[model samples]
Target: MVRPDKVEAVAEIAENFRGASASVVTEYRGLTMAQLTTLRRSLGDGATYRVAKNTLVKRAAEDAGVEGLDSMLVGPTAITFITGEPVDAAKALREFARTNQGLVIKGGFMEGRALSVDEVNRLADLESREVLLSKMAGAMKGTMAKAAGLFAAPASQVARLAQALADKRAEEGGAAPAAEAAPESDTDSAS
Candidate 1:
């Protein structure tokens, strides 16, 4: 005697679970619909927040083969499915919770593992993936530039030394006085 609507809901939730890069469960007990809308808007394009019955969510998780989140599906749960970046979603949730105080971050699932509330907070503290990647790229570029300089330094120094020696020889050639050869000429005559 299962309702078609219920089955559909489960399927939708399961699909969301499958498609999300990460999922965070939060308790939004005291927030009104308006506040919820505001929270949703704040999550931006990378995440979607949905309110669902705990039973339906549980069933969906089971269907989706997502484990370690059953305990998090308690008490007026709203799940945030993140598709872009997990850190961005976590940061949005954390920021909203800090201001609203009604959005309680329960836990999350990411990368085939469960995240505790502390872990979620830690995730929020991290920089976005793009930022981290750019920093790493900058560091690698700097290292490469340094290596190139290290590889080229000795050759450049040797070239400069050779040029300096050549300039000295040229200057001596230009400054050659016939008087300096007088001693040699005198020795040759004595011989």
Candidate 2:
């Protein structure tokens, strides 16, 4: 029989699962208290770094409608529940792992889909939301600028052609004979 406190813990984990945008399970076997603290601080407030029981976490994951997470809850597992930005959480964990050899990333889940370690690492390499949005905005601005240029190209060509024609006429001293007054009206009534 499970204790009431255990049930509450599971409930709390389940709630976190519901709110998390992504979660990564890692094996923190040889990490010191200070190292763990540093890692948690690096993850920032957007991510929750918790060392919960595997069985309770499995139960919470099941309750939260996320499947296939059981296989990743192996030895010395600690889960990072990402709230604000999944990419940020991934980046934090990746950076920590780079310096610390003991922290091994097992796997993760993003938007209810199971993700492999390689997939999580790829996510970590991604730029921030603002950078991506700015890139998109810059691309859109470039496209609009090109479209504006395309729209004005014909009018610019016409204006250039008119100027060239006027310049040639000015250089020639007058309009062409064909464009001059139709041979002055011949009135021979006096003759």
Candidate 3:
């Protein structure tokens, strides 16, 4: 016998699970309401931090087809559902946990994989996507510049060689060879 409110809650939680790109579960056992509010503010607009009953969260996770979180659904639990960059959210959580001992990062799930606590820390250590993309773009641009230089090298070398040969021939008074090597006209011989 499920109450309508409980059913609605489950549906809402399940929707949050489905809509989130990544979710991290944490135990907020010793945190005060003020600390919780501060923590939520620190998470930024890209993430939503919500506290829910273990049973409801478990049910929601099951409904959303998200597994590997059953073991983390213990004690006073809150979940951070990240809609934006997972790395940013993970970093915020890790930082907040460092200062606020009450917040314990249990684990997280992202990119169709369950993340362990250490994995979540590693995720936090990663640079933002935009940074990584810009670095790769810079690398590619350098490669392209090198390729262009490589392509132009042979042509420039050939031009320099031709110019050098011309200068050497001019220096040796060799221009007369060009006039002397001209072909004789067949018409003059026929006449």
- The candidate maximizing TM-score is 1
Candidate achieving higher TM-score, 2 or 3: 3
Query: Per-prediction TM-score, please?
Result: 0.89, 0.87, 0.88
Candidate 1 local distance difference test against the native = 0.95
lDDT of each: 0.95, 0.91, 0.92
Query: Cα deviation of 83 in candidate 3 (Å)?
Result: 0.7
Candidate maximizing lDDT:
1
RMSD of 2: 3.8
Q: Which parts of model 1 are misplaced by more than 4 Å?
A: 167-180, 188-191
Per-residue lDDT of candidate 2, residues 90-179 (tens digit): 999999999999899999999769999999999999999989999999999999999999999999999999999989988775665544
Candidate 2 regions off by >4 Å? 169-191
> Model 3, 120: alpha-carbon shift in Å?
0.4
Encode model 1's per-residue lDDT on 66-113: one tens digit a residue: 999988987899999999899998999999999998899999999888
Residues 1-191 of candidate 3 have per-residue lDDT tens digits of: 98999888889989999999999999998999999999999999999999999999999989999999989899999999999999999999999999989999999888777789999999999999999999999999999999999999999999999999989978666766655555344445666
RMSD per model, one decimal: 2.3, 3.8, 5.9
| C-alpha RMSD between model 3 and the true structure | 5.9
Error of 1 at 65 (Å): 0.6
lDDT of 2: 0.91
